[model samples]
Target: MCSLLRSARALATTVSLAFIFNASSVLADVPQAYALTDIGSLGGYSVPHSIDESGRITGYSYTAGGIRAFSWTQSGGMINLGSLGNDKSMAYDSNEAGTVVGTSIVNGQYRGFIWNAASGMSAVPCPPAATCSARGINSQGVVTGYTQIPGGPYRPFRWSGGELLEYLPTLGGSQGYGAGINADGMVTGVSYTADPLPHAFVSNADTQLTDLGSIDGTTSYGKAINSQGHAVGYGADLGNKSAFFWSPELGMVPLGTLGGPNSYAKGINSADIVVGQSQTRTRATGFVWSAATGMLDLNEMLLGDTGYFITAALDINDAGQITAFGKDSYGRIRTLQLTPVY
Candidate 1:
């Protein structure tokens, strides 16, 4: 009787230990990426729109009454990049050299501005009677965006220092918007042609534009491009939008949602990691997608107010860091940063 009791006790102990070991191994396999921190506001609301390789961040913040552009450093605090003239300004994108570019409301009209440590904020000169906006700037100081031509349509423009050159014309529809540009001067955005369909397009350095048709049964829009000419954006899937990653080799590959039907791939880093937002069963959440890990929600990977609705990931860097915006329970906009736990 004593020997049987001892054997039963030992078997139970071994089973318990084996269970713990297996549980620990399963937990270890879970991805380690998570939200680093919330880039809090400057007395009001803040949203981080872009991050560079060095972990420098840029975006817009609303103060007591007006909006102001801001840049955040890894070690330094958030620094205000003041406006061109009026009370409203925004930093949409930044380059590796800390050069920031975006639009500013000056004298009651919108004008593009670029800022650097040396030059401060200066208006991107537009043609007489044209309103220009700079959307993206590459490391070489080349800016690409759009300008409204007098009595004509909005056309894409590229600025190298002081010279502003108009690139390929719009796809015959009335309007278009330039969203992103790469180091190679390749531009991507949405263009409306004769079919009245707003399709995504990629323009080469020589102004040759090619329309990257939507995933079957969807209308598409291009958001960002990386150095290797890969584009990331969203496309409607029979009325539901899903994030997409595109390259010359594979055309448009859908980055499916995180257990939901809607997803938007807002940014792509050089490593091909895509970041965006998706809809779960309960609410909207931000997600990072890679070939290795299918999709992960920012809220699940981070400890925070899980009730917040992550709206969009504006940009990501080579280090796998992401900058994004969302709405809190109070319906106010909030910015968040996610860092990879490698």
Candidate 2:
């Protein structure tokens, strides 16, 4: 089970004026700077997972009873997407239509669920006695995640409004995990290959999985995919990990660390701007990366002194809005939203 615990802006323009002036491509839709806003929690603490182009954020927050899935908007604040007769629910992704997907406990079993303003919360179809999770949903409302029967390996699955679409093809291995879906119906995730090593994979229009090799390591994971089919994730070798960006033309390229041995890329927008966490010489910090700027410490791009030390960026929308998690001055984890300034 993925624990909720596991998962920037700007005076940024003035400092990166050189890179902005020398911009080589429009793919560098880099923000000049960002204004940060603390997205208040439900009660105890909140962890956000995905942000959509409309700036809608979905994730889980602690409540008086237990963890509950929620979606936050600028106008609506935090809207609880209650679970399916249980106290535990986690929302991992949302689409342009405001459809959210994640896992919920139903009758003591973890089952995938989909929620929208129209339908509210509904269970995603899965095989009998199978545990399922809905990790990502696309603009078209296609859902991607994983399912597993008792004593069997996890199998990546795709679903739509009503039924399970199909089990995604694997790289000849027994286990697979699907994380994100793009508007084109492409799914990005990790699969165990015949060699039994975990490898990142992306599905094509034909629904076939293609392995995206590692960043000089034996393991790779495709965490999220954009509408353009580009994917972002991390690769691991032994104990060291490196974040990477993958495109059909460029392949997988490691986004260098902030100055330390480990970095993890978790989110990317259509503009190719990447966001994640990297280890700095002194501490772990959030980062935003692109071909034009390489990588910039997100903490250094703040417009003013925020009492938060950003540690990981979870998602970025095409509008350049970012949802991230960090520690406040009191060392409590907090969820934040960053909006780009012109």
Best by TM-score: 2
**TM-score for each model:** 0.84, 0.91
lDDT of 1 at 124: 85
- Positional deviation of 68 in candidate 1, in angstroms? 0.9
Candidate 1 global lDDT: 0.77
Query: Per-residue lDDT for 1-342 in model 1, tens only?
Result: 433333353245335434643554521222475545667777788988788878888989988758998888867768788898866999888887889999888777778889998979998877756777888888887888788867877777778886556655667677777888898988888887777788888889767778878875547899899987989888876457778878786587766666555778888887677788887766778887665555678766764455566677778888778888887778888877777665
Model 1 segments more than 4 A misplaced = 1-31, 303-311, 327-332
Give lDDT tens digits, candidate 2, residues 1-342. 111111111123323433543464454657778899999888988999999988999999999989999999999999889998765999999987888999999788889999999989988988768998999988888889999999999999888766545888789989999998888989999999998999999999667888999866589999999878999999973357778888886577766677666788989988778899998768888888876677888888877898888888889988889999888899888889998887
Q: Report every candidate's CA lDDT.
A: 0.77, 0.84
Residue 250, candidate 1: alpha-carbon lDDT: 59
Give the clashing residue pairs of candidate 1, or none. none
Number of the top-ranking candidate, with lDDT as the measure: 2
Candidate 2 Cα outliers beyond 4 Å, as residue runs: 1-24, 237-239
Residue 231 displacement (Å), model 2? 0.8
